[model samples]
Target: MRLTVRHTTTYRYAPPRRAVVQSHRLTPSVFEGQQTIWWNISVPGAWTGATFRDGAGDRIETVSMLGPVEEVLVEVTGEVETQDLAGVLRGHRETVPPTAYLRTTRATHPDTGLRELSADALAGADGDPLDRAHRLSRAVAEAIAYVPGETHAHTSAAEALSLGKGVCQDHAHALIGAAIAADMPARYVTGYLFVGDEPMGEASHAWAEIHVPELGWVGFDPANRCCPDARYIRLGSGHDAQLAAPIRGLAQGVGEERLDVSVDVAEAAQSQQQ
Candidate 1:
C-alpha cells in the first residue's frame, strides 16, 4: 500500500519571543515494512541546524528561529510504500539494546494497578513471549476505554488506567507500563495511521512496541485492538510520548503559546485519483 501524509502544526505566542529552537522526529522509519518515496519538511524562515539518525534508528532534525517570533509553522508532506509485516520491525538498523527500554520514564512508570493488570492479562498465556505480549495488549484494551477528550498531554499511564478511558496515547502508555511490569521490554512509537482521505483535526497515532525474544520488536495498538498493519506508518520510538513527540521545542522567553495541528493521511491511489 502507498500512503500519503500531510501534517501541519502551528505555534503562536501571545507576546513575541526572543528566539526558538526545536528538535523534530517527523521523518518516517525505514524497515522491511515501509519505504519512503519522497518526503519534505518545511519551517518557513528557520535555519536548519543539525540532522542525524539516533541510536534508535530515527532521523532527527533541528531548526532554530530568531525572533521577535510571533508564529511558527511546521509542515510535513510525504509518501511511503508500506507492507503488512504483521507489525514486526524487520530489516531495520539500530544500535540501542532492547533492554534499554526496560527503564521506565515518568509517564510509563508502573503502579500496583498496572502490575496487577499485567498479571491478569498473562494468566491464560503459556511461555511464548509473543503470545504473552499479545495477551498484555488485549488486557490493556479491555482496561481502558477509548475516549478522545478524557485525557490530556500530561496524563500518565497510571492516571489513565485509573480513569478507565483515554485516547491512543493513553492506551500506548498503559500497555508500555504493563509490559514493563511483566518483564517485557517495551517502548512508545509515534506514527501516522491511514484513516481515509477526509480532512481531520488529527491523523497522527501512537502505539507500543514490545521486544520479544523470538521476534525482536513487534508493534501493537491496544486502542484499535490489533497489530500495526500496512495502514500504519512508523516514525520514531522512545521511552514515552514526550520523548517521541514529533515536535519538541523551547523559546528564549516565557510567554503563553497556543498550538493547532491538522493532519490527513490517505491512500496514495485514492489521493491521486481525486
Candidate 2:
C-alpha cells in the first residue's frame, strides 16, 4: 500500500522569545516494511541546520527560529510505499545493541502491578519469545481501556496500569514495562497508522517493539490488539515516549506556550489526486 501523510503542528507563545531550537525525528525509517517515495519537512521562518542519523537509525534534523518568535509552524508532507511484514522489522540498519533497550525509562518503569501482570500472563504459557510477546500484548489490552483523555504526556506506565485506562501511549508504555519485567528488550515506537473501520486511535500512533531471538524487532500495538502491518508507517523509536517524541524544542525566553497538532494519513492515489 502507498500512503500520503500531512502533519502540521502549530505553536503560540503569549510573550515572544529570544530564540527557539527544535530537534525532529519525523522522517520515515528505512526498512523492508516501508520505502519512502518523497518526503519534506518545512518550518517557516526557521533556518534548517544539521541533519544526521542516530545509532537507532532514526533521522535527526535541527531547526532554529530567531525571536521575537511568538508563533511557529512545523509541517510534514510525505508519501511512502509499505508492505506487510507481519510486524517484523527487517533489513533495518541500526548500531544500537538490542540489550541496550533492557534499561527502563521513567515512562516505562514497571511497578508491582506490572510485574504481577507480566508473570500472570506468562504463567501457563510456552517459552517461545514470540508467543510471550503476544501474550503480554493481549494482557495489556485486557487490562487497560482505551480512553483518549484518561492520561497525559507525562503519564507513566505504572500510573496507566493503576488507572486502567489511557490512549495508545499508555498502552505502549505498559507493554514495554511488562516486557522488560519478563526479561525482554522492548522500546517505544512513534509513527502513523491508517484506519479503516477499526478502532485505531489517530492518524498518529505509538506502539512497542520487542526484540526476540527469532525476530529482530517486532512491532506490537497492544491498544489495537494486533501487530503493525501495511497500514503503518515506520518512524523513529526510543526507550520511552518522551525520548521518541516526533518533535522536541526549547524556547530561550518563556511565556505560556500553546500547541495544536493535526495529522491526516490516507491512500496516496486518492490524496494526491485532490
Candidate 3:
C-alpha cells in the first residue's frame, strides 16, 4: 500500500507580531514495514528553524522570518510504500529485548489511576493480555463517548476516566493508564487512521502501543477496537500526547494566543513500486 499525507498548521494573532519560533514533528519515517520514497516540507513564512527525519534519525535547518509576520504555515508532503506484515509483526521479535520498553514516564506512572492495577486484575472476564487490553480499550471507547465539547489536549487520563467522556486522545490516555496498571509498558503513539468510506471531520489521530515481552510494540486503538493495519501511518512516539505533539513552541511575549490546526491523510490512488 502507498500513502500520501498532507499536514498543514497555521497560527494567527489578533495583534500583528514581529517574529516567532516553532518546532514540528510532522515528518513520517520509514520503518520495519514501510519505506519512504519521497518527502519534503514547506514553510510559507520561510524556515526559521526545522528538523527532519525518516523516523530513525534527525537533521536540522534554520531560517529567519521575513518581517511583520502574523501567521506561519508549515506543510509536509510525502509518499511511502508499505508492506502487509500483520503475520510477521504479530509474532515476537527476539532481536529487540522486551525489557527495553519497561522504562517509565510521567504519564505511565504506576500510581496513575488506571496504571495502579495489574493486567491480570483488569482482565476480569478475559484472561489473555491481548484480550484484556482489547476489552479495556472497548470499555474506554464506550465509556468515553466521543463528545467534542468534553475534553482537550490538556485533559488528563485520570480526569477523563473520572468524567467517563472524551475523545481519541482521552481514550488513548485511559488505555495507557490501564496498560501501565496491568504491568505493561505502554506508550502514546501519534498518527493517522483511515475510516474507509466513513467521513471524518478531524485530520490527525492518536492511539496507544503496548510492549508485550516477546511481541514488541503492538498498537491498540481503543477508539477503534483493533490493531493498526494498513490505514495507520505513525509519526512518532512518546510517553503521552504532549511529549509526542506534532508541533510545540514558546514565544517571547505573553498575552493570550489562539491556535488553529488542520490535517489531511489520504491513500494515494497509485501505489509505489517497492
Over the stretch 76-98, how does candidate 1's per-residue lDDT look in tens digits?
99999999999999988999999
* 224: Cα error in model 3, Å: 1.2
Q: How high is each candidate's TM-score?
A: 0.97, 0.98, 0.79
What TM-score does candidate 2 reach?
A: 0.98
Query: Candidate 2: which stretches are off by over 4 Å?
Result: 197-200
Residue range with the least summed lDDT across 10 consecutive positions in model 3: 87-96
Tens digit of lDDT per residue, candidate 2, span 208-254?
99999967999999888999999999899999999999999999986
Clashing pairs in 3: 29-54, 48-63, 115-181, 117-181, 118-182, 119-182
The C-alpha stretches of model 3 lying farther than 4 A from their native spots are 48-67, 84-121, 124-129, 270-274
Task: Give the clash count for each candidate.
Answer: 0, 0, 6
Q: What TM-score does model 1 achieve against the real structure?
A: 0.97
Candidate 3: residue 7 Cα off by (Å): 1.5
True-structure lDDT of candidate 2: 0.94
Compose the digit string of candidate 3's lDDT tens values, residues 146-260: 6667887688877776677777788788777777666666777786655555653345888887775455577887666667777777676667888777766554454556676
Best by lDDT: 2
